[model samples]
Target: MNMASDHAHDRPHEPPSSGRRRFCQACIGGAAAITVGTVVYPIVAFLKLPVRLGESKPVQIPLDRLIPGQAYYADFHGQQVVVVMSESGPRVFNASCTHLGCNVVWDTAHSNFHCPCHGAVFSGEGQVVSGPVSAPLLEIPFEVKEGNLIIS
Candidate 1:
């Protein structure tokens, strides 16, 4: 064969596809997926974060207006909380159960709060008395300001 023919034959042949281009495309797709997940994860998590102190705007409630020994519910800082006036003083606690975030109902007959979701029982002071709950009721930071209950 001639010199040109020999040189052309010596050159390595490649498939129609470009390996480097394919690799780069795959890398770009992976990076895009990661970016989208990172951005969307936080947005969804922020929206789902449970109600905690300072997250809900605090409010002042006229606790004295409520009948003593009776439980009343009010929205405190975006959280559904129960306020009770006992001989000790005003008690404020989150109405949500610690076990599964279920709405607890006040058992006036039993003088305690009961979770209908799992039958968890909590004292009027928000202390867990029975059931599968490992933690006590969440207490709202509160103080009696001029006979009004201020929860923060």
Candidate 2:
């Protein structure tokens, strides 16, 4: 019998070095992150309210805080919507620009909505005033009641 070989075989294996242990831990963490990102991101986005509506549900936005002659940006069904109070009344408009689907910001000085992309300009009522866009932003359906905006 080979006593030396037998004794060596019976000994417990030595632990991995610190560098190897760190590498293994990092690999495990990376794999876990990848799995979560691939699985969780889509699920969370789907569960939240979508920007677009298929079956319209009414969302009440309190208007007590809104000031006349000012514009308000709000989330409608997890999508961005803009509201402005004009001489006629409060109106809701899509926050996305007509050109390239870029977002528009309210220009108080101009009394219009300006798209940072392509320099497209729209009226506070969502009408296209100038720039590349030929069409105006689509108006979202909303009704005012008891100092609140009921949007669908």
Candidate 3:
């Protein structure tokens, strides 16, 4: 055989169909699409506005439902609030602890609010009784209309 013919026979020949090349290109494209989606999905989700759980309206509770020296809990403007019936009248306060914004639980046995996070305590009247808290519970404005206790 001639030198050119011998050289051609010695070298490996590429497949005429090019199927393997097409398959590799498709795989690279798919991987790029997946990588871009993984990076962009979280950003798109974060940019979307959060769905609010509750409405921004006034909260109302019947005055008769309040028992003396007992605590009543309610949700107001997406925040947990508490109402305590004192001897003088009804008092409303935010249930969040002043120290670390933890939810304060009503200790019925002690007739006070207790913070489970940091061992803070609050009086039934929303005063800081003891523990790490320096500020009292936040007081919410309310009005008594007819037989309903209206909290705004």
Query: By lDDT, is 2 or 3 better?
Result: 3
Residue-wise lDDT of candidate 2 within 1-152, one digit each (tens)? 69988987896765777687789999999999999999999999889976664435566778776777789887666678888888888888889887888889999988899999899999877898999999999888887889888887
Candidate 2, residue 43: how far the Cα is off, in Å? 13
Measured with C-alpha atoms, the lDDT of residue 141 in candidate 2 is: 82
| Candidate 2 ranges with C-alpha deviation above 4 Å | 1-58
Candidate that beats the other on TM-score, 2 or 3, i.e. the better one? 3
Candidate 1 stretches greater than 4 Å from native: 1-57
lDDT string, candidate 1, 4-121, tens digits: 8888789676554789767888899999999999999999998995756565666677865877678888776556888887778778888999999997898887789999988999
Identify the leading candidate in terms of TM-score.
3
Ranking by TM-score: 3, 2, 1
After superposition on all CA atoms, how large is the RMSD of candidate 2? Answer: 10.6
TM-score of each: 0.59, 0.60, 0.67
Q: Output the TM-score of candidate 2.
A: 0.60
lDDT of each: 0.84, 0.84, 0.91
- From the highest lDDT down, the ranking of the candidates is 3, 2, 1
Alpha-carbon error at 69 in model 2, in Å?
A: 1.8
